[model samples]
Target: MASEGAEYDRTRGAGDTAEATGEGGRETAAPPDPKIAAAVAAAEAAGPQHGETVRIDSWIWSVRLVKTRSLGATACRGGHVRVNGERVKPAHSVRVGDEVRLRHEGRERVVVVKRLIRKRVGAPVAAQCYID
Candidate 1:
């Protein structure tokens, strides 16, 4: 009976292992990937690593400058966006605290960067990235 039960346990699924062991198995609480863990630890040890300043063209599309990322691209195409007093293309990369000028629908606006973000964000979260 003991040998048969041991064989059954060996073939059990991950869920079964968790239930039987009273602790979530490696499938549920696995350690972070070693490479990612090392990277994170290194970054943490780096002590508030300040990023290098970048140009606005490099950040426009990536940070969702306009409505859509593609819209940011179009705005650059249409000469509606300028970085650091120079009209730039979508390829311009923006750095933290860089000044930006944007023209849409014949209206011009200015902003300063407070943060750099690559993901599309909601209205409230998006506000955190720039100063209008």
Candidate 2:
């Protein structure tokens, strides 16, 4: 699962490298791109990718998980959702890779983000947008 420009985890034992996980688990020593590093630093400095907090209505709402952002917002307002392990309002901001925990109707769901947008995208697109 090798991809270009992936960072290796140096903490692993030497032979563990061959297990060869990519991206989150990549084991190869790859150099960081200066340009990318600069851009990432700038984004971080500007704020958390999507900002410290973002309104649910402004995001590509995860409908299936909790129904419309409005519903999600309602749930959030009612303290049904948590961002980074803390309960937040429906308007609490989210960004790429943000971990979300959703509780609804006695069931709990956990998801990790793979993308973020400011519009209502279709189901397939929304699915692609998350990595739960």
Candidate 3:
């Protein structure tokens, strides 16, 4: 047991890309694919193309308004989330241009939907999804 503990293996984490690339130090992020870039740009430029909607909890979580989907749902259930001047449920569908008010961390965050995104994105991208 002592020998085994002394011989413990040290493995790199998934994020240790530099070590994988011949100790190149931090690796730069490759440019995004053009097709995906175009899609994201279009999505950021416009609202939902069709009569599309996403759950309020999902939208809030996707846009980083909350740390997790469950937190967003809890806020909705606790009446801490409101849409268009009315409290809504976690499953309530949030449409583009609707105003959302979230009471979180002892302050109220009021924002309007500029774009609808169903997936969590980077802070920059998430910031584009709403109007502060």
How many clashing residue pairs appear in each of the predictions shown? 10, 2, 0
The ten-residue window of minimal lDDT in model 3 covers: 23-32
Considering only N, C-alpha and C atoms within 3 Å, which residue pairs clash in candidate 2?
53-93, 54-93
Q: What value of lDDT does candidate 3 attain over all alpha carbons?
A: 0.82
Among all windows of 10 consecutive residues in model 2, the one with the lowest summed lDDT is: 23-32
The sequence of per-residue lDDT tens digits that candidate 2 reaches over residues 1-132 is: 353223344434444754544542422232254544444344335433434454653452643565576777788888878878998876676777778887888998788866555545445445555777
lDDT tens per residue, model 1, 24-57: 3533453345554444344335322366444454
- Candidate 1's TM-score: 0.54
- Candidate 2 lDDT at 98 equals 78
RMSD of each: 10.8, 12.8, 14.2
Error of 3 at 99 (Å): 0.4
Candidate 1 wrongly placed segments (more than 4 Å): 1-65
Residue 7 miss distance in model 1 (angstroms):
49
Best by TM-score: 3
